[model samples]
Target: WQLFTKPLPQPQSKSQNRQGGEQIVLLGLAAMAGALILAIYASGATALYNYSYKAGLMLLSLITLALLYWSLERLVRSPWGRILKAIREDEQVAKALGKNVFWYKLQALMLGGAIAGIAGAFYAWNLTTVYPSNFEPIITFNSWTIVVLGGAGNNAGTILGAIIFWAYNSITRFVLPTEIIKDASLGAFRIMSIGLILMVLMIWRPQGILGKKEELTLGQ
Candidate 1:
């Protein structure tokens, strides 16, 4: 208990350790490389194989998502990633272990903001125009729903959750309108469905599909 309470010793050689800036730079470089490959493939695939433009764009988006997921997975497995987890679990614990918790939190925010920026840029490109109306308050709730359905700390689960969510959206858009609900109440029904699903999940499996019980931090 005393040892845990005491501040941990700092490393003697700071230069030997990987810095946050270096990690960010590497992530940026990886994104750039992935973008370059995507551009080359998009052009060649469309021109040579006669793939539809929309198909090519979809392929590019999938490739970009894969690259981002891979990069993030790598980062999460690194020592610095462990520290981030520690901070998430308990900032005071991380501070006691000699980590600059505030700095790590800032880095996390920066990384998240960058990823959101990339997604926004891709969305604008896909739609060919951006509208303030596109980003409704419901969008934030939907994101939270994805996280909850997928489980926090599980990247693959998040991806799967997204796929499921879109599938649900498709059904609501096409089938529900014709078969079940009136158009006026469809939006309310959709939100209600999501809420019910969340309630069921919370009751039966709060940790989510791919989440471990130990990794569950709902109340914490």
Candidate 2:
């Protein structure tokens, strides 16, 4: 969703071509870090299902998401925010104006990750069990669908997108054919429909219903 399509650091960045070697290195490091972290936590697996498990996990996720977004908002001190906006408009010009472009991008990445983390936590909560297959790329793809349907760069639009998408999702649960199709099959098709809706909107009304075109454009 917001993490995938909206751009790397917003999907429309100029130097986005990460070479093969670079990708491999990045992924390798990520895998190694993941393994190390898992090893460190291997001894604490039993507590994952204790009485306080749900509460603790939920609270941790909530706090993490809140703090992450809060830090980003703080960075948006009117002047700095404007600078970031201008950078979003044209990075070269922002740098010419003496703004720290790299730092701003880094901050944006952190903020974006925090935002995605919030979405992920909500997703995790809604699921009764955790498994590898559940977190397929499609989940993110569906989120992008929601984001695009509501409008890019518009948090309100993202919320609306979530609402509409979920509505469609729930409706299909009881409305789609049952004799010829199971609930899981309907849900899959519904997600695909959401993706299709996103593509259609991008072609017909990219700005979304309540969003400004310029503000909701690919970059800005």
Off by over 4 Å in 2: 1-77, 179-188, 216-220
Q: Any runs in candidate 1 off by more than 4 Å, and if so which?
A: 1-53, 177-179, 217-220
> How many collisions between residues are there in candidate 1?
0
State each model's CA lDDT, in order: 0.62, 0.51
Best by TM-score: 1
lDDT (C-alpha) at residue 88 in model 2? 61
TM-score of each: 0.74, 0.60
Which 10 successive residues of model 1 have the least lDDT summed?
16-25
Superpose all Cα atoms of candidate 1 onto the true structure and report the RMSD in Å to 1 decimal: 9.8
lDDT (tens digit, per residue) of candidate 2 on 1-220: 3433333233355444211111222222222222222222332443567534444544554465345435544554557666666666666666678766666655555545545554444555434456899768865555556556665444445546655665676567766679877866786787677768777887889877555688633244
